[model samples]
Target chain A: MIEIKGLSKKYGSTQALSDVDLQLRPGEIVGLFGPNGAGKTTLIKSIFGYIPYSGSITLDGEPVTRKNITRLSFATCEHSFFPNIDAKAHAQFYKDHFESFDEKRFNVLMEFFSLPKDKAIKHLSTGQQNQFEVIMALCQGADYILMDEPFAGNDIFNREDFYKVLLGMLGPDECVLLSTHLIEEVSGLINRAVLIDKGRIIGDVQLSELEESGRDLMDYIKKSFSYRSDRVFEALDQLVPEEERHEEMA
Target chain B: MKKWLSVLELHAAMRFKRVLLVLGTMIVLQMLSFWILGDQSNTQTFFQVLGKIKYGWIFALGFLAMYWALSWPLGRNETYSYTLQRLSVTERGSVWMKFIFNALCFVPLVIVQAGLILLMAKIFEAGKPFAGNAHGILIDLEKDGMLHALVSFSNPAQVIYRIVYILIATACATHMEVLFARKQTPILSFIPPVILLLINNIWYDEFHVAFAAAIIISVICMITALVRCRGKKPLRDILEQQEV
Candidate 1:
């Protein structure tokens, strides 16, 4: 479980995240949805304590810090493994470094995936590298896992396989916080969704509640943004009469 | 501690190519010096050869130092997304592991080079067919004092001093490299070590002070590097008022 309060991050002239609050419960799989530059990654990083931000982040009620990061595992789309080493060596290194690493589980995952153990990580395809990182992350046996666009480079089969393995590996006590733009693919996988735009949380709704609203995940997302955008247009229209607005448009 | 050590070992193994390249370059330079100076028995030639070899060692040290410094920071791009993902699972020991990994890489290389030199001297002395002052080449082995100096690891005091000195130096070098890489001004990373070397040269007669000063500077640099990395701020934060 994770709690973020009044989280704000600024990048010089641009605000990446502003006054955002979020909470993730154990055994919950939440998908973070946002367009490019929507501060989705910023929010995730801030929660992970990767960057210095004006916010309070607590993991399972404990304040997040460098000392306690071993309790969390993060996987991103990029090749996070040491590119020069083989998969087995990389896994062994992680097993040695992380207190909670589950070597048997990792071996099982690797075996199931049929990931080449001897090939250098650099030689692996982008999708394979992503899989390897995911496998390593899961092996940490941490209670919380954060994934950023884990499906980015994967083929359809690999992506589906990843999701299956990921879900299969999750115990009842584990929670997953995933951020990705592939809303449809992840819609069925996540129990909750957080939509962010322009450094603010635009919507936070349970997937079931969102579904009960009688709209598909994509439709609901589009409608939410459209409704917000329409309010801005309506406010602008109110500043001037419809005739004036029509004349200006003409 | 064992876990951290294992990680360090894996890191060194992953960086095998870079380490091999540095050691290979040093050996080549050593061989080239032997070739150019050509088997002369004159005292001047011996001194000249020794001088070049010493300088060669210094040059190799500099190269290795630079390589060690840049290895982690510049080896990969520091994207916010990537940093966030990595931080999720990373431990503080991960940072310390980098320093230990770099140190472990040089251990075997340095030992093998030193051992081979001593072994070759013994072999030549046993087969005294060519009598052209082979004793001069083997002088370091004959004089226990020089041998002790040459094998710095064998002297407890020297070992402690070198360990502390190299640890600090490497740590600082690594820090400067990260700082420089973040700013995309890697060129400036060389300044700290260069300045330290200059100070060492100026106070060469006071070897104790020079060594201490180098170690102190390296420790300071390492501390600064750790401080800078304490957050997820883009390494470029040091170079400019840029945001990520």
Candidate 2:
């Protein structure tokens, strides 16, 4: 379980996240859907204490700090593995460093993904690297797992296999927060959806509610951004000649 | 204990090739110098050779320290990928543990070098059948007062001083490497260490004073790194507060 409140982040004059709030419960799979630069990565990084931000975040009612972070696991599309280390060695390093690392589970995931154990992480295809990252995170056996764009470079089959492996690996006490642009592929897998645009939480609803509303997740996301586009167009129209606006409309 | 050792092992693995290249280069250069000189005997020649070796060691250590300083920001950024966002207090122990681990790795290397020097002295004495006073080299070292001054500096005091100084340098280097490894402004992390190193060298004539000053400065740096690393707070809180 995690609780985040009034979280805001700024890089120089540009805002990356703005007053967003959310709560997650155990055993829940939440999909964070957003377009490029939608603050999805920022939110995920913030949860891992990788970036500094304003406000409060707590896991199971305990304040987050560098000490207890070992209890959580995070994965991102960005290359984090040591470039020179092969996949097997990287996994071994993780197992040695993290007490909760499940070596058996990691090996199984590697087998499932058909990742080359002897290949240096830097040499792996992007999809294989992502798979390796996913396997590493899952093996940590943390109560909370945060993934940022984990399926960025995968083919459709690899993506499907990843989802299947992820679903099968989830325990009753674990929760996973996956941020991605590919909402359609994971729509059915997620129980809750948090849609963000321009650094704000525009929609946070149950997946069931979204389906019941009969709007596709991708369409809902487009509509959320379209509202801003519409506002901008309206402002532009007000500056245009009346005859020109009418002609354009016709 | 295990986790800290694992961290050290990982650090070594990551920097293994670089360390090997540096040490290998130094050893080869030293061997070449010895080969060209034909043979080294007597206190005068021995001091010259030892002086060169000492300078070589210092240069290598300084290079390592600078490299570590330069890489701090990137290493820190890379480490964040594996770190949990929530700020907790456990990093204090982790930092100290890493400091110890790095010092332990370097200890054997230093001892082996010292042992080789002593063995070289014995071998030189064995080859000269005409030379009656073989122990003169050791006596001369004791008289020139560098070795005596070093050994009798404060009995066990010098060892402690050396250990602490080495630990601080290694710790700071390792921390910097982890902190600055992949950041847009990773060079920012090097500012403090470089500034301190420069300050220590400002009064070049005061070499002894500067060496002591450098040790103190490194200690302060280690403390600063521990504070910054331990106080890391999660980014999620920042995201939630954005006005978007």
Candidate 3:
């Protein structure tokens, strides 16, 4: 289990994360949903020890040091790959550094994505690069996989297929904490949703609970965020003149 | 140990092309210098040819290539510093491995320069009375200030001083590379090595004091650099928050 407690991060004057607490267990896929600047990326980076934080994060009761860091893998839209290296070379690198690297899964994903294995990552299309990023994170064979908008550049069809591929390839011991804005897209894939706003987690809910209550995932989010359904109409009414609105209605 | 080798291999492979380019250009320029400055006269000395070669420019180009290679992990597209920092290796070990790998990158430069010197020595052997031999050629070339610390292998004390000097220079450059990776411009980091080199040149006769000072300064610079590599609270963190 990966546990985070009282996590807080301050970027100079801005609080990127504040008193955030979360836990991730094996065999579960959780979606971390947040608005822009809501601290989703900051939270993930903090867990990976990419940045220093004020709170404690541990894996299996030990601090996330180099000894057990291989248990975690990350994929980001900003890309953490060597641009000069090709896909095959990346597989070789992962194999060298990560003892649990799954080369078979890497090859399978390369073929599935139709990514050119020989081309350097920088030469690949943006969508292909995104795919390769996620592929590396998955094939690292880590127990906890953290992805931040890994499919940002990928098309909808590609993302849908990838989500299915992810579900099929994950073993019972694997856990995924995926942060993306496409909440509805991953609604079917993730079992739990972790929602954050203003640098604080506002809601954590299980999909099974929402299903039992006959609540749509979107409706649940709307209620959690106090979605103003008529605010759009009110803003439009204010923008348009009364005479113009009446003429359009007529 | 195997992981360190993998890291070294990755760095070497990534840098192979650019190193080749710089070395190729350097050799061609040296050859061109020999051709332009060569005289068939029996009086030709290795110094005559080396004197005409733009040694300063070559050194700058070679060292600049090394600096560029050392900065690879901090590239803009993806900061592999994060990758390396999270590795199972100790922070100090990783920094040392990277520093050693960069030092190795300079081997080709030395080989090329040494080869040129040997070739010149062979070509100008007929003028031995004037050119003196390969050892004499090195002794002759050591007259220059910067090369003074590096080439006096004949003297045991000089050998030790040279090692310390080289370590200081390499460590300073590595420190600068790390700072640059963090997007911090450290113009001051280049000062210590330059001052040491000047001490070597200006106080060549008073070897004991200069050597002691060099050893102390090199050790200090190395410790400072290793401590900065810890990445938790780098000395430069005051400049700005480290994004890595």
Candidate 4:
């Protein structure tokens, strides 16, 4: 279990995250949903110890620090691997430092992605680089894996396929916190959705409850970000005459 | 110990090919310069001809090697969060590992220099330059004595301090980049070396003092770089926003 309490961050004048509290538990796939500039990346990055924050974060009851940070891993869309080395060499690097690294899992993931082990990772297309980055995070054998916009470069089919593969391969003791703007794509996949906008989290919903309410997940999220619910309807009404609006409504 | 060595070896491996390519190029260029531009007409010994071209090549070598060392471990654009988090040691360990690897790369240059000097000496001995004075070029350096022009490899003492001094220069440049470039620290990062160089110039006498000065200054700069690296903001910020 990982816990964050009163986490806040600022970048110069911009408050990237504000008084945020979140928890990541074992066996849960938590979706971090937010609009553009919603501080989705900031929240998770702070939890990962990428930046300093006012609050405390703990991994399995221990305070987060350099030695214990390896227990949680981060995979981002922007390329991170050394461009000179192949995927195999990257795996070796992880294996060298982290005792929990699972070679078998990495091999399986590579074969599934059809990633050639010997070619330098820099030569891989952007989408493939994203896939490899996610693979490394998952196979790092950490208790919690955090991904930021990892599926952006990948095709929809590949993204869908990876979601299923991830669901199947995740150990019961491991968990994931994935941050992305593709709310609809992950709407059905994630168990719980945490929504943030303008540096603060506005909604936390168990998908099961949202589903039981028969409210569309995307609609619920859009409402959280909505200032005037009728604004769109009013604009459309003006764009189309009353007779046409009535006809469309009908 | 083993993990630390693994880091060094991996870093060395990543750069080994490029270093070899550069080493080969420098050798060919040096040989070409010797054949074409060497001061054969005016000087007697290989050392005098070599001295004319030495400073420029040394500056070039130091500058090139130092730039690479500054970006050692990884490039500016690349994120090290993944690598740093996985490391068994502190982030400071990353810098130390890079230092070892970058220092090791200097070894080949020294060996090649020694070989070139020995080969030149052999050529100079075959009645090649003087046809008169086999004692070799004591030309402008006669004040330093003819013995100073003796082939250096047979006397390792002649080359070791020079190698150490070059390594120190490279190390200082590297630490400056780590502080000024990577960490985005204040201009104070440039101070330590300047102060140390001043002190070193005052104490300049033999290999003993130069070696001591180099080791002491390199250690201090490494510590400063590491302290700044750890205490400073994570590199992810610049990498996140910059064109890289």
Candidate 5:
């Protein structure tokens, strides 16, 4: 389990996150939801130690450091790779540097995706590259996988297929913390939803609770983000001919 | 140890083609000059050629250290954060790995320059219109009262000082690359190396001061890079407020 307490991050004068507190338990898939500039990426990057923050964070009751970093895997919309090198070369690098690297799993995923081992990663199309990124994160032998916008560029078919593959591979002791705008698509997969707006979490609810109350998760989430139901109707009404409506009324 | 070697091997693979392209161009240009200037008109006299080559080497090494060597160490901007996260390497460790790999890559540049000198020596021994062999040219230059231009090459201690100076220059460049990756403005990112190099130039006549200055400057650059990489942020709270 990972625990976060009194976490805050500032980007210059802008407070990106403010006194954020959270916990992540194993064997659970948690969906992180937020709109643009909502501190979602900042939070992910903060946890991964990519940015500076004021916080106390621990994993399994020990402070996270370079030595224990391998226990967590991460992928983001901006694909991270050695563009000049091939998958096979990267696999070798990962194996050498990460004792937890599962080379066999890496090879299997590469084969499954038809991502050629010898071709430079830069040569792959954007969607395929995103797939490869997710593949690398999964095969890193991390118990916790944190992905931010990992499915942005992928087509629905590929995304669905990968979701199935990911579900099959996740062990009972593993956990995945995912952030995506495609909340409805992952509505079934995620056990809980955590919503953030203006650097503060507005909603944290279990899928079971929503299901028990017969609430549509998407509608509930849209409410938290302040989505108005009348906007579409009002815009369509503006398109009608005012003179024609007046004549009909007369 | 194995991880470091693996990174080295991977870096070599990534850069093999570009290195070949550059080195091959150098060799071909050298060989072409030798072939085209076969006992010909108004070309550089052998001593002049030798003088120019020595000067050329200094400029080439300096240029490579300043520019070509740091791009990889900076780690490409687009993929940097993601790569670090997935690979699970601390920023400091990643920078050091690339720095070492780049320093190692510099070995071939020296070897190729050495090879050019050997080829020139063999041609001179074979009675090409060369005035003297490689080392002999420096000896001849000193004999001809041309001491100022070649004084650093004239003594072993000065040669060692020159090597140390170049190391500091390159080390500063590598750290600058890290700062640049941090997205510092152009002038701020460039100040440290420029100041250090300026100090080296000012103290050039006083060898010990210059050497000590370079060492101190390089140490400062290294420390800044280390501190920047050792950010207070830890990896456990990765997504407290992140929107997917």
Candidate 6:
């Protein structure tokens, strides 16, 4: 389990994360949903200790450090693999640095994605690179896998296949804290939805609970965020002339 | 120890090919230098020729090119550093490993210089045996001045000072490149070497003072780099905003 408490981060005068608290447990696929600049990336980076924040983050029982960091893995759209090195070399690197690196899983994912093992990762297409990034995170054998928009450039079909692969590959002890804007697409895949707005968590809901209440994930998110459904129409009303509006109504 | 070796091996593997390429190129350049000297109508002893020839620039350029190449993995566009930081058991170890690797890369250049000098000396002695001198080919240390002072190995103080200065300069420069990659302002990286050179130029008579200053500044730079790296404060403002 990863526990974060009173996490706050500031970029100069602007607050990136404000007293944010969240916990991730085993066997749960949680979707971290937020609009742009809502501190989703900040939260993830803080968890990884990539950036500093004023809070306490503990993995299992101890603080996250080199000794215990192997338990957590991350995949970002920006990519963390050595660009000049091939995927096979990356596997060797992971195997060297991480004791729990799953070489078999790495091979399987490489074959599944049809990524060239010999070619440098930088030479791969954008979508293929994204797949490789996610593959590495999955193969790290980490208990908690944090993916920040790992499917950014991938096609819908590829993402669908990956979601399926992820489902089939994940063990009961593994947890995935996924941050993405594809809410409706991931609705069926994730067990829980964590919503953040303006650097604070607005809602955290279990899919089962939403289903019991006869509500879908999107609708529940809309309610929790107090989303203005008529804002688009209101903006259009201001854009159009009164005569044009009347003509359209007629 | 095993893990440290593994890390070292990984670093070396990533750079071994490029280092060899650079090393091979430098060797060719060294041979070319010798060839050019051999063609000259007015032949001189090894020390005199070495002091006169402008081949030192090749070594300087080689080291500079290598420094740039080594900085590639840590550049903003690359991600090897993220893996490296996470994998390293201690940031200090990473610093030391990089320092050692970079220092070792310069060793071949010195070796090439030594070998070239001996080869040039033998060729000079064998080709022209017209001398009433007892040593056959007279070694005029004073004739070659500064270059001789640097690589002659005749003056123990000068040799020791130069080695210490080069090692420290390498450490500072390598550490500075790392700090720069992490988005930190690293102007201090060039200060030690530049200051040492200026001191050497201005205070040639007070060599001991310049040597002591080199030791002090190198220690300070090493400490600063180690502490800052261990802190790992990559700028938060420049953090990649990947999420929507």
Model 2 agreement with the true structure over B1-244: per-residue lDDT tens digits: 6656665565566555555665565455555555455345543445555554443344344445445433443332254334422213255555665565556545544453444445555555565433414566566355433243233335576567445545655655645643443232333334434443443334323445555655666666576556654445322333344432
- lDDT score, residue B190, model 3? 57
TM-score of each: 0.76, 0.75, 0.85, 0.82, 0.81, 0.86
Give the residue spans of candidate 5 off by over 4 A: A235-250, B7-16, B33-45, B51-62, B72-76, B81-90, B124-155, B185-216, B231-244
Better of 2 and 3 by TM-score: 3
Model 2 ranges with Cα > 4 A deviation: A65-71, A79-100, A116-126, A227-250, B37-77, B84-89, B126-133, B139-161, B164-168, B171-175, B178-206, B234-244
Candidate 6, B124-162: lDDT as tens digits: 666655531226333443444334544557778767766
Native contacts retained by candidate 1: 0.30
Candidate 4: the clashing residue pairs are: B45-B137
Residue A74 of model 6 has an lDDT of 89
Kindly report which residue pairs in candidate 3 clash with one another: none
User: Which pairs of residues collide in model 6?
Assistant: none
How should the candidates be ordered by DockQ, best one leading? 6, 5, 3, 4, 1, 2
- Give me the displacement of residue B188 in model 2, in angstroms: 12
Error of 3 at B151 (Å): 5.4
Question: Which candidate comes out best when scored by TM-score?
Answer: 6
Top candidate by DockQ: 6
Error in Å for residue B59 of model 6: 2.4
> Candidate 3's C-alpha lDDT?
0.75
Interface RMSD of each: 4.9, 5.5, 4.1, 3.9, 5.5, 3.2
Fnat per predicted structure, each in turn: 0.30, 0.39, 0.36, 0.32, 0.45, 0.46
Error of 4 at B88 (Å): 2.0
What TM-scores does chain A show, candidate by candidate in order?
0.87, 0.86, 0.97, 0.90, 0.92, 0.97
By lDDT, the better pick of 4 and 5 is: 4
Which candidate do you rate higher for DockQ, 3 or 5?
A: 5
Q: What C-alpha lDDT do the candidate models reach, one value each?
A: 0.65, 0.64, 0.75, 0.69, 0.68, 0.75
